[model samples]
Target chain A: MEILVAAILTIITAATPLLFAALGELVTEKSGVLNLGVEGMMVMGAIVGFAAVHYSGSATVAIFASMLAGASMAAIFGVLVLVFHASQVPTGLALTIFGIGLSALVGQSMIGVAYDGIPQLHIPVISDIPVIGEIFFSQDGLVYLSIFMVFAVMWFMNKTRAGLILRAVGDSHDAAHAMGYSVLKIRFLAVLFGGAMAGVGGAYLSLAYSPLWVEQMTAGRGWIALALVVFASWKVRRVLLGAYLFGGISILQLHAQALGIAVPSQVMSMLPYLATILVLVIISRDRSKIKLNAPASLGKPFHASR
Target chain B: MLPRLIKRQSPSKAMVYLSPILALLLTLLASIVLFLIMGVSPSGALHAFFVEPISSIYGLTELMVKATPLILIGVALSLGFRAGVWNIGAEGQLILGGLFGGATALFFYEKTGFYIIPLILIMGALGGIIWAGIVAFLKTRFNANEILTSLMLSYVAALLLNLLIHGPLKDPDGFNFPESRLFSDSALLPILYDGTRLHLGAVIALFFVGIGWILLSRTLLGYQIKVMGDAPAAGEHAGFSHSKIIWTTLLISGGAAGLAGAIEVSGPIGQLLPNISPGYGFAAIIVAYVGRLHPLGVLFAALLLALSYLGGETAQMKLNLPVAVTGVFQGLLLFFLLACDVLIQYKIRTSKKSESTIAPAVKSSIKSTSEVK
Candidate 1:
């Protein structure tokens, strides 16, 4: 029972970052922009968050710093793709490349810095409960925030007037423009929000997950989060489910070794990535389903013309 | 008045060739600012980073050595990009090629067969093809996104290489190092220039440039690829097979990347290590774009990008700068390049008060040209 609780905690730690990033990307794609720089933004957040915590000794500052770092990266993407009309695919690729390099350069001095993981929530009355309390209530602040954001995003996308405008822009920017909506403004805001969320996800990794500074520590989780967005078919609830599923798969390699499984550790490490490809293939095989859910102008550049 | 973009009636033909040069100059200017912030004299750092690396004959040859793999991979990626096949997993395919070629070299370890070198090259290409073939199969068979699958496979390939080097292919004769034994003389690429590490692979890469140019500019398949990228509906209407193009482009890229990997191990590396090619696969994507996706253009772009690698090393030694600066510079170059490409399709103009009309978009016949003056 104790071991199971421990495994669940690890899974939560693994899933929170994916959840944060995918939710952000979900919102971005809904605004007619496909930003593939989540990985880049996440890594930037990780370094900045770690550095902030190292210098200031405050997790709150670290988290905010990480978000700003991510947003700044996204702002660069926003200028190039939104204003300059650069191709989305290559521009996103450049963002990832630049983010990784900038993070490495900035984090060079912060190597070997370490911090104890962040404080977990302990509600006075509920904290004493056995399995349920420990599993659900005792997660770090980010985990709770991740769950909260999932529902928040759901409500925002389905209930809000602004959300409809964002969706309208995504489905057909020309029609959105015809309706007197600033398609670019809505998208730029969505992209910034996505960047901020990705930043928080990065902060969760450096501040709470490993609680250490290492270059490239996100370790392809950003890419996995990207697949989760697809696997969810652009639905908020499904994204929550997919993040946990992928998180569980990613942690299986660790548990397999603990359980004395005979598989090579390297082979086991490949599971999450392989699972991602498998999941993508399955979800993507339903071409019409993907088409129905995917934003019609998802990767197309928008040029508002008279 | 806010600056606004006016759509060109047709893309500027001059910008097609000129944008890369503009991007390069902008990158150099950015580098000056970056260096100034780092507390180094901008001119000294720029000289150390760019000119000092190619000052000697050996340095120039090393530039070619670095550029060879880049040229090979860049040319193939350019073709794929033209065909709308984004195979970003060339790095993984390259690693697989290295593993396959290294295995063949190991198979002929201590043996001197004349055909071993050619056999190693073929196996390397086969390794890359098989790796990329999975992506092709998935995309064509299941309609999977090639970008995500290929990128995922790269991580897998790296882990696979790690596993083999640590276990089955570990150098038995040496201390338990996580690397394979050095290849025999027959398996190594033949030297082109004595007293320098220049090898036959450079010539092979140049040969592919000619081949890629001919295939892209002079073939029916090339025409089909262009149509598919520019207008898939039109290509389908014209009876071209999308699946066939995907297969052709992916295989060519994978094969080229794999061959480059094999050449690296045979030519300069001489043995398998835990890490090989040092991000050559990712950097090739930049080369393909900066070269304007033209074969002859890619050749020059490859050389310039290759100089970044050389300059990074020189700066590290001379100016006490971190090697990560190279990656930063490379990314900045790509960013600037993409930004400049906007000039190809639009003319930037200052928005005049008379040109501030926004409500006329609803009328289909309202032309913006009347407000331009």
Candidate 2:
């Protein structure tokens, strides 16, 4: 019972960052831009958020500052790929490298500093329940926000007019331009949202998950989040499921080590990445199914020559 | 006000020469800004970054040592990229090559014969070729995106290395550190000079660069690669098999990357450890591009990038600067290069509603109509 409870709790915590990141990436990809700089952005968020809380002694400010920083970085990427018409792949890679370097350079001083993170909030009746309450209703505010954001993104992408325009732009930028929609404007907004969400995810690491800043604290979570987007098939709800599943795998590796499992840690560490690759290969095997839902102008630069 | 229009042009001879130099100048400017933000004097930091590394013998040796793998990998990456094949998994290939070659060397530790080193080198190159062959096969057979697949496979390769070093390949007598047994003197790469850590790998790297240059400029295969990259349909019409090119490019590149990895373990490191690579595979991608994906250009670019790695360490110890500054410079250089490349392809033209615009506009409209048809 205790192990099950612990696993469930671990899943939620692990899922939070991935959820935030994948949701952000979904928005970016939906706008026909693939930003591969999530890892870099997340690291910057981790450092800035840690610095904010460490200096100001406030979690709110740290989280807010992280989002701003992330959004700003994303904006630079948006300008390069959207306005300057740079190749999306190389630009995205450059953004990531820039982010990683900037974060490491800035984060050197804040090593070992701990922040007082946001505390858990529990509902009255739900808090009193046994296992269900402990698992579901007792997470910190950010975890709840991540779950809410997932549903919010689903609704925003499906039921809203802005969502429709965003989808139309992603499906076919030329058609969207022909229909008098501002493809660049919609893409800019989507990219900004993605950047901000990625920032929040980074903040979750420093402000809540680890409560400390470490160089490359996001590790390869950004890459995992990128993989999760493909695994989710670009659906909002499925992103949540994929994130939690990846989170579970990550946590399982940690717990296995703690329990003195005989399996090599390196092999175990490869589980999440290997699983993601396997999922990609399987999904990509039948190209037609993927083509059905894939964004038509995904990763291609759109230039209006009117 | 009228929006400025730009006329696209074929790349000129002068611009081709100027692009990299301009990119470097922009990178330096960006680095100065970065140094200012980090509270270091720009000139002093730049000196520490570039000049100081080549000043002392120790630093020079370190630069050469670092450049060995970079030169090898950069050459390999240039070959594939010139043919328009993006092999982003060189890091993984490098790791696998190191593991295989290192294992072979260790296995033959007792048999200190004349042929041991040669055998290990061959095995290392073979290891890299096999690893790259996986991506090549998938790409040719299923039309899978090599960029994503190659990159993802690198993670698998890394994990396999980690598993080996920590588990089965762990040095038996050593304390709990995750590393393989140190290679014997017979297994190790011989030093080139009397005092420095620089070894035969440097010579090997130069030899490969020469070979790469010859193959790219003079061979029929090289022409096929260029044509394939420039116009895939035209190459197909010219009777070049896309699958064959894919296999050839990946195998050659992968073998080069693998050879570098093997040399790395045998040379400076002398042992297999958990974190063997400092992202040499990925960094070589930048070096390849900065070199314009040309074999000889890759040599110079590799040295410049190698200097950054050496300088990054110097800054870390002397100025208390973060090592990530190296990565920042690399990223900045790539960004500036892309910007410069745009200028190379397109000439900015400003007009005030004049006669010149009418002719170009009419031509563009005609081209657009034909393109639509």
Candidate 3:
């Protein structure tokens, strides 16, 4: 019973960063721009956030600083792809490579620094409940915020006028232009939001999860978040489910190792990644179904020549 | 209103060649700015970045050594890019190929047979082909986006490689450092030069480049690939199957990437370490694009990129620069190249009234909500 509760808790903790990143990417893609630099942005966030916390000795400031760092990086991407009419695929990838390199260079001195992590906030009354309370209400504030952000994102996308405009820009920039929409501005905002969220996700890793800075510390969680965006089929609610599923797979590998399972620890570590690919394969099997939900102009660059 | 710049019917052929050079120069200028920001002299940094790495015999050999896998992967990627089939998972395929080829060599480590090395090479290529075939299969069967699928599969492959090295393939005699057993004498790639680390892999890369050039230019398959990439509808109208092209391109590229991975393990590293490739698969993407998906062009780009890798190490030792400079340069080069490529396809005209008209169109696309449906 304790193991079950622990597993659920592990899943939530593991999913938090991915949740933040995928949700951010989801919004970005929903606006019709595929920002492949999420991984790079996340790493930059992790490093910058860690550096901020290390220098200032404040976790709140670090998280906010990370958001700003991530947004700025996204803004650069926006300038390249949205304004300059650069190819989306390569530009996003270059942003990632650039981000990773910049982060690594900046993070060289911060290899072993430790930061005071954000504390878990347990809800009153619910804290005393058996397994459910421990699983749901006992995580750090970021975990709850990630969950709340999903609902918030879903509502914003479905209900808000701004969300509607963003979606319109993504669907067909030409038509949106005809209707007096600013595709570049909407994409810029989406990219910034995505980058900020990715940064927050990165902060969760350094400030909360490991509570220590390491070079390339986020590992491949950024890639996993990118995969989650695809697995979610570009929906806010599905991103939450996908993040949790991947998180569960990640935790399961550790649990399996602890259980003295015959599988190698290295192989176990690959579970989440392999599961992501498998999920992508399964989800992508029905092409027609996925095409309906995908942003039509997701990877196409908007060039206004008229 | 400003006078409109005359729109050329087509870009001059000389400009096509000049663009990449201009892009390279722009990249150097941008990197100099980066160095200045880092408080390093731009000229000294450029010297450290490009010249210092290839000045000595040892540095030149090291550059060649690093260039081997990159050349192979770049050539493979060029083939696919030319066909419009983006096999971004070459890194994964390479790892899997290394695992297979390395395992083969390890399996026969005690044998002093003549065929051991040859068998490893074949198995390495085969391993890559099979790995690539997975992506090809998915694309054909499900109409999956090859870019995301292949790229995602790479992480899984890397993890699987890590698992194998730390578990079943763990070096038995060594302390518990997650690595595979060293290849026996027969399994090791014979060094070409006595004093240098340069091996048969470099020769193999050049050979493949030549072969790729021929295949891309002289073969019917090459024409089909080019047609499919440039005009997919026309290719279909001409009775060419997109599925066939995708499979062919991915398999060929995957096989090449796998071969490079195998060669790295067997020839140079001699063992399967957890992170054997410092993102060679990913780096090859830059090499492929920077080379403009041409075989001979990829050869030069590969050598240049390899210099960056070598320069990164030299910079690390001499100037206290981080190794990330190589990545930064590669990314910057690609960014500049892509920026240059935009000029190849579209001519930029700056007219006053036209510029204002463009801004509103660009702006309006961000405002309209009714167009989403």
lDDT by residue for model 3 over B312-370, one digit each (tens)? 88888889999988888888888788777766655656664454445676667765754
Taking the candidates one at a time, how many backbone clashes does each contain?
A: 0, 0, 16
TM-score for the A chain of candidate 2: 0.96
- State which candidate has the highest DockQ: 1
lDDT of each: 0.91, 0.85, 0.85
Cα lDDT for residue A297, candidate 1 = 93
Residue A61's lDDT within candidate 3 is: 89
Runs with alpha carbons beyond 4 Å of true place in candidate 3: A122-133, A258-260, B1-15, B352-373
Candidate 3 lDDT over A1-306, as tens digits, reads: 988887887888789999999999999998889988888899889999989988988778888999998998888888778765677877888888888888888888898776668878777989769887777677787887888899999999999998888899989989998898878788889999999999999989998988887877887788789888888889888898888888888776768866667776666776776676678788888888788989998888776544
State in Å the error of residue B130, model 1.
Answer: 0.5
Best by lDDT: 1
**Alpha-carbon error at A303 in model 1, in Å?**
1.0
Per-candidate TM-score, chain A: 0.98, 0.96, 0.96
- For model 1, which pairs clash? none
- Provide DockQ values for all models, in the order shown: 0.84, 0.53, 0.65
| Best TM-score among the predictions, by candidate number | 1
